[model samples]
Target chain A: MEENDVKNRFKAVVIGGSAGSLSVLFEVFPALNPRLNVAIILVLHRKYSGDSSLSDLLSTKTSLPTKEIDDKDPILPGHIYLAPADYHSLIEKNYSFSLDVSEKINFSRPSLDVTFESAADTFGPSLVAILLSGSNDDGTAGLKTVKEAGGFIIAQKPETAQMPYMPQNAINNLEIDLILDSKEISDFINMLNQ
Target chain B: MIEDEEIDLLLNDVFEIYGYDFANYSRASLKRRIIRLFALDKFPSFAELRYRVRTEEDYLKRFIEEITVNVTEMFRDPSFYKVLRTEILPVLGTKPFIRIWHAGCSTGEEVFSMAILLQEANLLKKSLLYATDLNPSVLEKVRKGIFPLNQMKQYSESYIASGGTKDFSTYYTANYGQAKLNEDLSEKIIISTHNLVSDSSFNEFDLILCRNVLIYFDKDLQERALKLFDESLGVLGYLALGSKETLKFSTIQARYKQLDKEKIWKKTM
Candidate 1:
């Protein structure tokens, strides 16, 4: 797809990671336009508890409003939604978020695979999924599902990743469209709104 | 894509035919699940799925399971169980007899988890755990009290993390790739089919656990369920929801006090 097509085709962007995602997100979130026209859903594997500081922490870094997702909360454009700890955040066909406390996959609750697969099913070809630095292969099958759904897939360049296993696994298992460093990924997102 | 009108009609058909109300469920979640079911069953469209749902008796049962089934595990969110063990159970132990309701107790994993906790506290003999769900199929599984043996490893880890007092292995016996929970644990549990959306509270309880089940409902249904919980709970009783669920946004928010950071609320009003 052309750069212009990339900006026009997608309705939502899902970013997933685990071990080293927060630092990368801190850099990327600020680079994107505050009023971008797509929903941005993030799943970063973290401890299961009520005292989540991620949404608060991300809100400080980005101009776009950021909040931890509540169950059945509508998915709105130009907002950043962080999946709350201990629940698999799924995208509904009617464009809302649903939380599930089912068994943890890959020993992580907020499983990237669950969210990515659900979002792929919900958004189909209009979705763009990015797999970032992490120690596990949880998001590999999910990115594959996105690819099968005709959505775009990007993996953070493994050589530059803090934890290379996650993105590397995706690249090995799926036809990833791009392998960019953190800065380049930010630049790509920034280009989407131009 | 199924239009809103199409969904509304389909939901109404479901209600009229099966008497299972999906009319007030969160539309987004319900639609997604329906679409998913359609795709999984290779139905041509939502209309086709709806036809089968209305006409076929077997399909209705499967469709209901597909929509309402919540995947759960033993001692999910160890910290919640930790708080329940250390802070909550002791308070309940002081009473003469405790009546606890596990509403929407899917497959009885958490029900048995609670029974184990009560047993360790020496309160099992005096406690009655009423485990209920909207689905009778899952309730049947709950009555058997058998879980796949493979899951025992994960449940054991969760058990230890949740501060189990005895060897977690002692709670079950493994055979034929399945583990049967001890009769002692199962004895305190009474499995029943109860719908939170349509059914009234059958018994008042000192503690009620309606965990991840509420996340599937829309605002109106959520408020209704909260009202039902409020009515069911005794004074100073306890209510526990899923980790992500909260009373903060509900109509009954002010009636309950936060007992822990893990979504345990106590009836204060």
Candidate 2:
């Protein structure tokens, strides 16, 4: 499949990471290809509850409009949505967000598996999911769900990751479609714009 | 395993036959929960799921409970509770009788937390905590005032974080891995079933906390619920929403003064 045939091919791009993921985001968001106009979602492992500083911190790294997700908030194109702390953020079928205060998965709220699996139910083939650096095994199962749903899956090249367990686990267990480093990651996502 | 149209069909059948209105719930969360229930019961097809809901009276109860999220904890957001203690409750204390309505009070965690706050402030006996939910199964738990024992450690941490001073264990008695909350706390609570979609305001209140409930409703339903809250609040009353939810876009925004901290808003008139 031609990767650049991505015009209208996707509706939302979900990015899940932990540990060294912030540095990778800093690297990727600075030169993002603006042509890619789909919801860019980030689910990261963090401790603080409802930290607006994280949004303020990430917003300076990119030009895309970013907001912390509230329940029932619409998932719009070309926007960046951060999952709030201490709740499992689930994407609804109507292109909106919902929150659950259920028990943690893999010792973390905002589990990548929860969001990716829910996003798979909604976006299906148009869902492009990316797994980045992390110490735990949260995103692997979610990436598998995306794969089974026929969504595109990308993983950070293990050596390029500060904590490679997460992306490495996906690469080890699932049939990952693309493997990328921090430098190549932005270019690949930007290429999806075409 | 449920199809989109089948969900609509089941929702319609449940409403038409049982008089339960879930048609306006935010479809995403509703569908996801429905799907979870379907798989948990191991129904092979949507038809079986539909048949069970329609034919079995007891199954309908289970279906409703599953669709509505009841996974809550005491002081789930400790900071929100902190503001409630330091800022919101202090003013409401001056009233002769404090009436608080915990709308969509699932499993009654937040209500108990409020009761603890009131008790700590030496106001529980004079306060009426009206805890309501659409599901009666949970209201029974609220009445019983029991919760899983394992959760107490986390709740204790949150309790301290929320500026609770007493030993948290003093609030409940434990046996067989279940903690029964103090009767004194439950003493002030009135548990009932009230559907936000169909129910009207029953009493005016000093503080109304409908946290994380409106997120499940569609825009029109959210507006309707907000209006109901407006009608239920007296002048200088406080209205609290979930952290992410706002009264800013609603019609009642102009009259309410948002507090400097938290999502609490005070009704000026």
Candidate 3:
């Protein structure tokens, strides 16, 4: 259960957050070692039909390379992948991203639950699910699946989150591993990796 | 019996008897619709529903309604159609002859919308619009080109938002409670039944509109339909989707570039 042990085991990291998530991303992305041999995937809830330039918007705040994943691109270390605005993006065992137009759940196509569950299934114990700021409890069930599969689960401290529905739901749904504010969260993630 | 098994059986029976395939549709939506069908048909059991659909005429009609997801209206998204008119039309206007495919055309409203746009753009004379859907009943209604006259008031507003140049009422004639579209409009369209899931591409087209249709399909089905669209589109052909659909997760995403964020993508080799 050591943090370094968790980091050494995972080949990649997966994070799910929404609503007031940009602040969390700014803190988290810069803390991880740029030289770590691990890829990062972030899922942010977005309006189903709006134009989203999240990857472009995030690129300016982090030194890590960021791009909206295209179909079947191999997941590589030193890069960050952002799911596009309206589709659920999944990672195959081959490390390529798969896009799906399957019917929406809870009226959203790019459901956090879809991305997190699929990632947990694909990566098993190597995966980490984080629920941050959001208006809905979208990632609660998915984060539970990750925890049940012996993966890591983290939530933003509800009082620190701009929208607390998501982090609070994750906490109420499962016995999560860690709950921290943005400052403490970055330090914990970095220390875990080291 | 588990609901999954019952749905599998229903899909099997549909394929075996009607030659229609629902096997590849997203499981959640398909299951929901089948449940609605059962409720509407008053079938006491899944077996009874299957038998009635297999044998009874009235049941088959009801089954078609449940199976076909026709959520559409005239100019459903005004801004998208606005872009289609201002940006897409100019490119389409250059072609001496144009063939457009309105895939998944439901109730013919969108096909008629495109036809009206073409007519105003001075391109209808040299244009051929093929409007297709999997539901034969909807296709038949589309061929008739008559819509409930009451809906015309709302459609007129959409038409204006899409940048109508003339009176929207001029495109159709009111008869009793129905509005019959201009014969000239119908002349430009060929309405037929074509299942995107089970059918192959019929011909190369200058533009293909498969809006709000793929969201009902699973990943495999979406990729199949995307490949079909890619092949069916001629060089520099255009592909338009519902605002909620995109090429981002398809195997062919690299083969397209967003012409507009509103889901207009141009075919790229």
True-structure lDDT of candidate 1:
0.87
- Candidates 2 and 3 compared by DockQ, better number: 2
Off by over 4 Å in 1: A1-12, A18-23, A30-39, A45-66, A74-79, A92-95, A102-128, A133-179, A192-194, B1-9, B39-48
Query: Candidate 1 DockQ category?
Result: acceptable
Indicate the docking level reached by candidate 3: incorrect
RMSD of 1: 3.8
Fnat for the candidates in order: 0.51, 0.54, 0.00
Maximum-lDDT candidate: 2
lDDT of 2 at B245: 82
| Count of clashing pairs, candidate 3 | 1
Off by over 4 Å in 2: A1-4, A34-36
lDDT of each: 0.87, 0.89, 0.79
* DockQ of the two-chain complex in candidate 1: 0.43
Model 3 C-alpha lDDT per residue in residues B12-79, reported as the tens digit of each score: 87788878788877554455567656776677788998888787767676687666676577876778
lDDT at A21 for candidate 1?
A: 82
- Per-residue lDDT tens digits of candidate 3, residues A59-78? 87777788887545578876
